[model samples]
Target: MSDSRSGLFGFVLNGLGHMFRGGLLYWAWLALLLVLIVLGGWHYYLQLRDGLLVTNMSNQVSWGFYISNFTFLVGVAAAAVMLVVPAYIFNRKDIKDVVLMGDTMAIGAVAMAILFVVVDLGRPDRFWHLIPFIGRFNFPESMLAWDVIVLNGYLLLNFGISFYIVYNHYQGKEPNASRYFPWVLLAIFWAISIHTVTAFLYSANSARPYWHNALLAPRFIASAFASGPALMAIGLQIIRRVSDYPIRQSVIDHLALVAAIALQVTLFFVLAELFTDFYNEGEHAASARYLFFGLDGHTALTPWIWTAVLLLAVALLILMIHPLRTHPVYMNIAFVLTVVGVWIEKGMGLVIPAFVPTPIGEIYEYAPSATEIMVSLGIWAIGLLLFTLLAKAALPVQCSFLREKAHREVTHDDA
Candidate 1:
């Protein structure tokens, strides 16, 4: 018990140290994030003060960037399961070292996804209306309610499993967390379900032919895997450089393999969409037209969409080439570009399609208002800040364990 308390104290102090010592870049990022949050808050205040008329979103483009971000993040959160299944279940020793990092990132991603939903709400104060017992369950009938349950359940699963692993490490015990293996499996299925439900949320609204296809769910999964792993690869690279943590080259090589496969799958889905849309020559094709060329007189989004596609192609090419994927500098560049490309593709691509050929057969384009952009930035900042602090606290222990293992090996060699 005394040792447990000491460990807890040490954890708290270590976290505080990271908070202070996270350096100028960390603080600068935090400041930028805070500024965005403040600006978003002020914009939201004006929104509340003036009403929904503050921005361009109407009955046609009701969802906009917030909803798009929400959907994309669901995929991001689900990507963690890819890492977990291989490391914990298959006993992939290379990934074993970084599985905990994957879990920690899942927690942050899910939290941010939920935050985007909250910000997008017309009446965010009424968010508690979904609470069980206290609020209505409306199960089976309400997709939103289902989303709440699955998302919260998945969040708890991640938090529970992650805390268990970290706590055991703190006590210098081999985690008996294997008992929760079934729960981890359950979480994996739940991860898929969360993203599927998100896709369904858009698809079920049959009026929006752009999102109405059966392919949305599978495409979402593919995109999630590609973007999520790309982000993770970049994250691992950063940790390796900044701290004493020793992520093996083999681990990076394997991750690149995963990224490569996911990128291929995502590209296939994109091509499939093109084939379906052009072949059909239907209203659905209109959305693709808006994305590729322009719709009516609006071409604002076309250039940006093509730019993202170009970057994605470049990133995918780098990942496919063995020399580029193995090189630290090139791999990191590819990962960063891939993540940015996906964000643009998912954020604008998903939302704008729904607005084209509006309900009355009109087209309206959305550019996020200053306030909306700030709010989004704020949320992103919060995710980074949270991950930074958590990484600071958790990484030291993992690094220490790896160092001890290296020392043991060296001692054995000497003997």
Candidate 2:
């Protein structure tokens, strides 16, 4: 027991030590993250003191930048399933190399999503009201409560799995396959639930017709699959360039293919929703009109949505081409474009218009104030910082471990 404790202590201490020892670019990135976090903290301080009034969010559009980000990140967090299911279940060696990175990404994303929720709350001090033991947490009854529950569970699953595997690797031992497999399976299903519950949080709002649709949850999942893996594809490239780990081309190829399919599905769902909205020409269609084109001289969100659509189309074109998908240069560019396209589509494009020509027939245009923008960027900074630290610590150890294991196998074969 004493030896085990010492080993664990050494594992954590060694990992953290290497994470801080990075080159100039790493320090620059860390500096940038710190600046954003501090700036965001300042804005949040103002918000707490002055209330939601510090931002442009109003009674008509109660959810602004924070909720939109929360929505998008929930999908990103869930997207880790794209890697987890294949790597753990099928035991795809190519993907197994990078699966821990995906799970770590999930950890950062879930943490950021939770922070967004807490920040959006006007009275964060009363947060205990949402806790089961301390307050009236309406679990199973409140969709929000369900979101809280599942999100934390998903975080725990990812953090536990990622840490356990990496710990085993650090100890120069193969993890017990049986021990990790069930948890991997849990993460897969839980990923789906987290995003679905998030969608339901919006769809269940009977008053918001823009959100009250069966297709909303499906669209969320589709875009999530596209955006999350697209982000992961780019991340894998970054990891390979900076580290000794040789991420296989086959893994990148598979991710590109999956992202292409997922992006296609996202586009299809958007068209399906548009058809359902305009074809029937009901009261609900107003928000759709407000989004795609201008309605009643209100066109604030039009350009943004159209631009998202254009970028998605461009990204798809590049991703669909066999040669382009295989070329690292082209695929990485496409991946970035897809990430931006989805961010706009799911963030400002989806949320703003829905609230526009709001439920009470208020045609007021919603725009994020400077404070909101700063705070949003700050939350993102926090996520990136978390991811950067996690990858820095985990990757080198895992990569070296995989290398040693490979060398041993080859030696044994020769013997």
Candidate 3:
């Protein structure tokens, strides 16, 4: 036990030192993250002091901005698997080169996702309520329980894989493929399960007709593909620009194509939903009408939904044109557009509608208050900062691993 404790202490100290070690850019990034985290902590403190009353949430619309962001971040976390499929399964060189980035991205994304869930819980101090032995756990009964379990499981799996491989490379040692690849394959399946389970959480609510569709899971997955790839594209481009690590154009091209196709599929799902709602025009369409148009003078969410749709259309156009997808400037612009579009569509756009025009005919519009916004911004800061640090540490290890692999190959040939 003493030896284990010593090793654990040394490991943590080494990690902290590595994460904080860098020049001006690093410090500047760290400073920005610190400021945001402080703001979020202050906001969360206010929430704890006053209770959930500080937020604009009510019985009519219980879900708010925090849950919306959580939903979107889950998709981002799952998107890391796109890299794994091609790199591990198909043996793509470009993807193999930057797979570590995706794993680190997953770690950051899952961390933020969990934070958002906790922030939305309102009484986070009582978090032990979800504990199994000591507290009540719903398990198969509560989809929320499934979500909590899957999210944490996925987080641990990715973090473990990333830590082992990256640490080995950092120490100038090669990672054992047999030890990690099986876990990598399992992670891909778990990634999909996370989002699908989240979708089921919404879909199971029979009162929320808007979320009751069979296509809801598919919609979540497709939109996730679009937004997740967009994020990966942007991050990889940044890494390519800043570091000596090589990110090939082929990887960018493949990501863009995958995002483009998924965006088109997402558009189809939206169109199908729109038709079903408009064609029948029953009580079930109330939320859809509220979202697209105004339902009984409740036009609060109309602008947001329309803006998201417009952004989706613009992004689709950029991807449809071969020239635009190939152009670095246009491709990057499309990536940003798709990410924002999906966040609005799959996140707020989906969550808010389910609650509007409540089951008993309530029309209380929910908007996130200033405190909520600050808390969210702070959570975002935490996530981005985590990603920045992970990427920063990951790059050197990845580059060295690549160099060492190449050296071994050359030596083998000479011998």
Candidate 4:
């Protein structure tokens, strides 16, 4: 047992050493990550000194790109549950191959989501007040407090499950059965809770007609599944090109299927919203008009929204066609485009429309201030850096550990 433990320690250290000595692409990515971190840190300092006034966010447009990114990332985080359910619960082999990748992506996305909220807060320093036991939770009433609980809980669930799986592989053992099965169940429920709570956060604001509908939760889930699978597909392609890890083409095909279904659901919900707005012709219709057309003398965001719709159509077309979806190059291009298009739609498109005819009947537009943009970029850089290092250390074990253990078992049996 001690020998086995020592071997595992050596394996981890060796993986780290290899990453430091890895190819130019690895070094280049790390360097770019460092630059982003420095710039982001500097911007955060400026924001601290200048305050929220530095941001284009006014009383009308209180939530801007920051909140948009937060909303989008929560979906990304929830998408991992899709993979988790299939792999661990239903035992789907096609998704099992890429489950670790999905798990890693979830970790990265959740970390970024939390960072966005921290940066957006009026008093970032007071964020520590949410710490469990030490902080006031005001439960059963405050939806925001519930959001904090669900988000943090979901993060822990993902991290714990991922860590156990990786560590077990490192030790040449399959994960403990008791631990694995329970977390799988936890992950499934936690997945729904995270996105549902996020939607509830918006819907709870009855004054915000655009977000008040009962359909918000379903819409959020639909958007999340679409964008999340698209991102996973893109990440898989990157891993395939960069490393020796084997990702079966069959797995890519399965993810493509998921992306297609998600896109369809997203389109359905969006159309439903349009129908409700046009059919009703109330304040809600007026809000929808600003999003689809233009109102209050504001037309800057209309073109971008149309562009997002066109890109979504393109993505759907690519996925719906068999040849396009299966062709690696074309599929990859479509996946990247879809991810970017959704980010724009969910981040900028969703945010701007909510504030169109402000509560006080004035128009307010929001663009991320230089400091806000820089701080956001920095958080992204940090997430990338953490993920890169984690992949550097963890990927090797995942790729070879199981095979190594099998070989050892065969040797022992022969002996």
**Top lDDT hit:** 2
lDDT of 3: 0.89
Q: Which prediction has more favorable lDDT, 2 or 3?
A: 2
Give the per-residue lDDT digits (tens) of candidate 4, residues 1-415.
2565447566667657756877888899999999999999888888888898888888888888788888889989899877887888888866776698888888888889998999889898887788767877678688888888888888888888877888777776777878788887888888888999998988887777877899989988988888898888787878888987778877778778888888888889999989988885887765668877878677767887898899888998898899999988778777877787788777787767878777556776667888778888998898878777777777877878756765888999999
Best by TM-score: 2
Select the stronger candidate by lDDT from 2 and 4.
2
User: What residue runs in model 3 are displaced by over 4 Å at the alpha carbon?
Assistant: 1-15
Ranking by TM-score: 2, 3, 4, 1
Q: Give one digit per residue, the lDDT tens place, for model 2 in 1-415.
A: 2366439888888888988999999999999999999999999999999889988988888888898898889999999988888887787988988898899899999999999999999889999898887899887899999999999999999999998999988878899989988888888999999999999998998888889999999999999999999999888888888888879878888889989999999999998988888887889898889888888988888888889998999899999998888887889888998999999999988787778887879888888899999999999999999999999999888878998999999999999
Alpha carbon lDDT of residue 91, candidate 3? 94
TM-score of each: 0.92, 0.97, 0.95, 0.94
Error of 4 at 288 (Å): 1.7
Model 1 misplaced regions, further than 4 Å: 1-4, 7-18, 21-29, 405-415
- lDDT digits (tens) for residues 1-415 of candidate 3: 1345325455455557667788787798789889999999999999989988999999889999999999999999999888989999999988988888888888888899999999988678899999877889998899999998999999899989988887776666778999999999999999999999999999999998999989999999999999998999999998788678889999999999999999999999999999999997999999999999979988998889999999989999999999999999999999999999999988878999899999988899988999889999999999999898777766765786788889999999999
Segments in model 4 whose C-alpha atoms lie over 4 Å from true places? 1-19, 405-415
Better of 3 and 4 by lDDT: 3
Pick out the ten consecutive residues of candidate 2 with the lowest summed lDDT.
1-10
lDDT of each: 0.80, 0.90, 0.89, 0.82
> How many clashes show up in model 4?
0
| Global Cα lDDT for candidate 2 | 0.90
